[model samples]
Target: MPVLHSAIHKIDKKPDGTPAVLFLGGAEQVESQARDDLMHQFNESYNGTAGKGWGFFHAESGAFPLSGWLGKYLAGVGDFLKFSTIAVEHLVRLMEESNLTTGGHALFCHYQQGLTEYLIIALVQETEAVTMTEELSLLTIKRLDLDHIRLAARINLSEWKGNPQSKQYISYIKGKQGRRINEYFRDFIGSQEGIDGPSETRTLLKAFSDFVESEDLPEESAREKTHALVSYSMAQAKLGEPITLDELSGLIDEDRPKSFYDFIKAKDYGLSETLPPDKKTLNKFRRFTGRAEGLSISFEAHLLGDKIKFNPADGTLTMRGLPTQLTEQLKRATA
Candidate 1:
């Protein structure tokens, strides 16, 4: 939920500058249902049992026990799966075309499975420009099972401090760096070690499986810190005051000696590398001003500048000067 919110909240005109979403569903069912209805209408012509009642000729005659419903349901489900696959392929193609993106895009799915079952899938990609040349993309895959409950897995596809986006079609930083889309899905559904993927991938898959089995586990990752930053910003914007870096970390129970930003960069998002984020990584994203006595540091998003200023002395941030677009969002949120 947090990921989805961060991906699409208050953002308009996705990086593609278009609809960014390709929806496919129920296109053929209209025609098929029409044909079935017409046939049933004609069958109704049988007036009495002396001849053959409509029930005698077709499965539609028995509404409860249904005749052709099984076949129809299966066909419909097949079409849904087919379209969802196509949508993913299209999304990947779009990502390959644009080297950089500035918004978010996603594919949502919910299709019938059986008489009482349904399948749901959502693939999301949220992008934001961190600087002139660098961007951050959060990629997520979610699904709902027979219980109609949703579970998800996410990968931050952003490049490391010195790294750049790959020119190829499929790259997932730590895991599946150059693997294909299908390969990613296969590895996700199958075995983790089969693809030799990143630990984050394994963790997410385990989390998803555990959720389905009602064996959920606690998850702690550098990515959680990214979401924490977003959460902290939203809170600060609402309170109209800056909270100290230590206060922010304490609120989230992130007791690590190194900053969250630095830890994330060091881990490379749990890709192949493992390191804590440092001042260098922090400075790359923002201007980190450290306090000697308090041993606290404050940061300002260089891109946002004065709109979101930080005071290291009191360890509070004042967003009164935030950009017009973001201030408007804050107003809408608080309203």
Candidate 2:
């Protein structure tokens, strides 16, 4: 529960006469002491209101709403700050009063003004190890490492200075990377009047790529789930490792396109996944010219001694066992 909820309720007669609090929850001794302390603090306040914001004339202050303390947003002298709406209201007032810059430039200036630059880090905390390629870079590796990245990520996830939502934000961080990235979200989004650019959210994963290149996915399986899996896996893949079949299956839908011939031709040459025949596994490979047009490449082994092998019959790539001279021509052209 938030500090705001600490207040007890009661019914009252009023000028405007609206619905009123009918009763108060039973208060413990500690709460009573806290209430008295708040009252004393309010009496000692500079404004004598013990409250933030401009609404009250002379607040007999005893713990104002969290929104009240959001008035001053001096995050640092030269820093971009993500603030709550109340803080932004103060900013709008300041911007309106200033005559120095245009709106676009002013906002940009505010964003770039932060003292230290930060990064948002996200790690698949509970996810299994996955195959992946190069990690994305914001700056040169010469300038940072995993520790630096993690620390920068932490700063990004920080939340409201005096609100309970900040605790919720903290709970989202399961480990170092997740927490770091969470920080980035808090600082970057909390203070903004807008969203970040498309490039900011861009990510890549090899397991997903391998999955798309795999032979199992159905022709009409949902693609959205595949996209999300790829995104999540990419963040967790081991850099410089070849994606495994099992790993690939987990990250993308097993969508084999409807047309078998087109699927084979497209996936064989396009994806570079080796197609071999097997009784148990799904058969999706094709050869343009062969004894078994739709047969798996592994089955071609049984017929190897009798005629032209499927591997050598790879249309125009190899210059042998072809009715036409297309492969010969390509060889000649390259030569």
Q: Pick the candidate with the highest lDDT.
A: 1
lDDT per residue, candidate 1, 1-335, as tens digits? 01111111111225544643434333323334443432232222211101000001121323122113223434564444354444344444444444323223232322221222222222333333333323565544432111211112212112111232321111111222234543333232221221221233333223222222231112333234434544553343232122234454444345643443343344344332321112222232422333455443333345344556558899666655445876899799999
| Candidate 2 per-residue C-alpha lDDT over 106-172 given as tens digits, one digit per residue, 9 for 90 to 100 | 1111111133221211211111233434664343222111222111111211223343232221111
Worst 10 residues of 2 by lDDT: 104-113
Q: Candidate 1, residue 59: CA error in Å?
A: 54
Residue 304's lDDT in candidate 2: 43
Model 1: residues with Cα > 4 Å off, grouped in runs: 1-157, 160-162, 165-181, 184-335
Q: Candidate 1: what lDDT? A: 0.31
RMSD of each: 25.5, 24.0
Task: Quantify how close model 2 is to the true structure by its C-alpha RMSD in Å.
Answer: 24.0
Clash count of each predicted structure: 9, 22
Q: lDDT of all predictions, in order shown? A: 0.31, 0.26
